[model samples]
Target: LIWAAIHRIESGLNDFESQDIIVGTLGLLFGLIIANLIGLAFARLPIIGAYGPIVFSIVFGYAGMSIAIRKKSEIIALAGNLRLGKSGKDHGSKHKDMEFSGKLLDTSAIIDGRIAEICSTGFLEGPLLVPVFVLEELQLIADSSDLLKRNKGRRGLDILKQMQEDNYIEVRIINDDFDDVQGVDSKLVRLGRKINAKVVTNDYNLNKVAALQGVAVLNINDLANALKPARIPGEHMNVLIVKAGKEENQGVAYLDDGTMIVVEDGQKYIGSTVPVTVTSVLQTSAGRMIFVKIANE
Candidate 1:
């Protein structure tokens, strides 16, 4: 019966991939070594010395094997590092050379379309991966009955095509998907975890969710906000008053890049272009606002 049970256990282990077995074996060996060292330290304890090593060996060996199986990738990476050290290669430099392992583009970011311009600037590095599911989502939007969503979806497709044509960057449409996962954002987070990549998105909720899951997110909106021209009081610029603001005699204009400018006592100039002096600039989490008045008013 004992021999039959042992054979069954061996057969069950065959279900695990080779890497898992190797990592588990290494962990068990490491645990045994640690247990032996601890046991030797307790050798002077007259009562505990006799049984301590055997108990520690069994407990720690099982614990280590379980942990190693669960964290096989980490153990593999650690082993790779040791190999690189022995070969005298600077493994740290390899990581430094990469801006990111990979960048997975989400639907919102693709629709926002600034990612194409950002990539064209040669600032973003590494492969840009667009999952098949994200493409399907875009197609769904393109086929939507709503005009706005259709246009946005088509625009995203165009941006993606442009990025693919750029020779300086690598854009890959990945087929890897998780049907078991529900939302696109959740699938994106899962894919990022699997590939150890960062998610590029313009979604606030996805950003928060990915952060909670310890996934890196490159928010395109945050990038745009960061890249906006910095303005201060006394700066003068031309703006066209597009509409009236909340305050009396206030006109609202927008910069070419969409920074809102509130003009003081200039409601009369609605629908007209005029020069305005920056009175103050308020930087908020939502966006940047410039308060201004007609120059020389």
Candidate 2:
């Protein structure tokens, strides 16, 4: 203890040459000195002087011992939990395919609502993965003050619960978290790459980013477009003009399938259902847009 004190003072004297080392060494020495000084001052007091050091030492000794034991136990518990998780993963591989055909569901997919229908039909094969972070985000939305956001969050939870009950669907919650990631979309892409699973999302930007990274994406919008009924020019169909379109004299209607139908000169037919002939169809990466002209009523 005396040797340590001398060494610390020597380092402090040569502070400029070894500033950080001196500061750290001196800080320890200063604490020890202050403690010893306090003990000495207590000893100088009347009747308590004889038992001062003993009582103080005993009190601090037990506290230090308890803290040491708690820290050691925590380390052991952490190691054991890690070992158990690894063992479960090893054992679980025997039943499920080691090469997971799992689908990593993104935030948009959960909110889109069509995934529930698709899952009901058994099209989405393999386990559906919902990251722990994504679940937390959904919970936040559910608790949000905004009515629409709260409803969306509640709907997501409902869908999750429905999936859990369906024997055809296997839902897996991945506890992986990327602290460096800000948005859920980026994290979804990162997770998809790590797990070698396809991403199911309705987010257009996420779809594009995943594709650039060579991560397989199962976009709901793409699926919807593919399943949408093909409409040829001159085909007659009745549609409800819900609103006016971007162009003059054009109105917009949506099929039960949610495909937008732009009816020319159907602006006047807004808020009414009318028969229309398909004039043209525009298919974009976004989705299919149909142009039509209301048939002379």
Best by lDDT: 1
List the global CA lDDT of all models.
0.84, 0.77
- Looking at model 2, the pairs that clash are none
Model 1 clashing-pair count:
0
User: Which candidate number has the best TM-score?
Assistant: 2
For residue 12, model 1's alpha carbon misses the true position, in angstroms, by 36
Q: Assess candidate 2 and give its TM-score to the true structure.
A: 0.63
Tens digits of per-residue lDDT, candidate 1, 169-199, equal 8787766778799999999998777766799
Per-residue lDDT of 1-297 in model 2, one digit per residue for the tens?
A: 999999997886674323234333444454445556667988878877877766655555455444433233233334455665677776874534233477889877887788888988988896788888899989999999999999999999998888788766877676667899998888888877776678988888888999999899898988889888899998998999999889898899998877888888888989998988998999865889899887885
The TM-score obtained by model 1 is: 0.61
Query: Which clashing pairs does model 1 show?
Result: none
Residue 252 shift from truth in candidate 2, angstroms: 2.0
